[model samples]
Target: SQLSFINVQNRGNFRWPYDGLYQDEDGTLSGVVGGIVLSPDGLWSTSTTCTQTPNFLNAKTCPSSVGRWVRYAFNNANLAPNGEALFIYDTSNHYTIVLNLKKRLTHPDGYMMDLLTRQSYLFQFNGANSSVNLSYTGVVYDLVPGDYLIIRHNIDYIPDRVYTTSSSILAASSNTPLTAT
Candidate 1:
């Protein structure tokens, strides 16, 4: 069914996804803006470019505030590396996937790793693969996330491969495959 805006006097059952939005049942829920939602167990990334105030509601609980808002309001940048990349969660399925440039990496699918000397070059793909779509823009320095390019690497998929590059280079590669060393 197509959605059509209506002038109903009440929107009774429509509760927002966030806890503090649309209502003020909690004493401290009013007049607040901006919030960060780090999934049940998700990583928190920080960037030097972010500048904004986070909501008081989830201030202590949210792993990131301004960065989260920035990434959301404007998709995460994939074209260039930033001043900081803070990854705090560890899962078995999250991996770093990068665009294949010049056809040098060996996965036949452009599955190039930062290094080729490790036991596995693949990272765990997070649970959102089904909804992801990736695009190659010929560079990684400032890649914006939602062309649906999911870079999650699963260790289980590339079992015999090892990441030859350090985590730093891997992080950089995720932004632009050309500048990685």
Candidate 2:
């Protein structure tokens, strides 16, 4: 069986884990084109560069002015038998982010299943500094003899002032335990 996950969140004042800068078509030093940032301790950070091409079918183009794309990933380890992981961080300031999921399944008989799922999470960084840590749990299911699963991640970052609500999704295949680690 295959599995995937994606998380989109408003990341304010957070630096990219690496040093390279992202550029746009005009050659300007763009932030990020929607990619995942992993910390030294294996924690996930929401930092992405906006891109012109819509990677995910459900992703909508950000208005010309806000050229920010969502940042997240589909980790293969999350698909191992009884596999489990966490996705989270803190937004030191009040911000919002959108998380989406896309799954594809293929059967030996040429049958396929494609599905899209999404949720939003609002982070209010009440700390004195402009930093926050958000996290989530992930789990995968076992394959029934001939079954196959494919998981993808879709993320979108929206400015905090645009919306005031947030959402989240909790899914499980078998009875896998989800913890913050």
- Which candidate has the top score in TM-score? 1
Question: At residue 141, what lDDT does model 1 achieve?
Answer: 27
Q: How does model 1 score by TM-score?
A: 0.20
Q: For each candidate, give its TM-score against the true structure.
A: 0.20, 0.17
**For residues 1-181, could you state the per-residue lDDT of candidate 1 as single tens digits?**
1223365432222122111212222323222233332211122223222222233222222312223221111112232222112121223333333332333322222222221111222232233331233222122222234321223332223233223233246432333222222
lDDT of 2: 0.25
Q: For each of the candidates, give the backbone clash count.
A: 31, 23
Assess the local accuracy of residue 34 in candidate 1 as a C-alpha lDDT between 0 and 100.
38
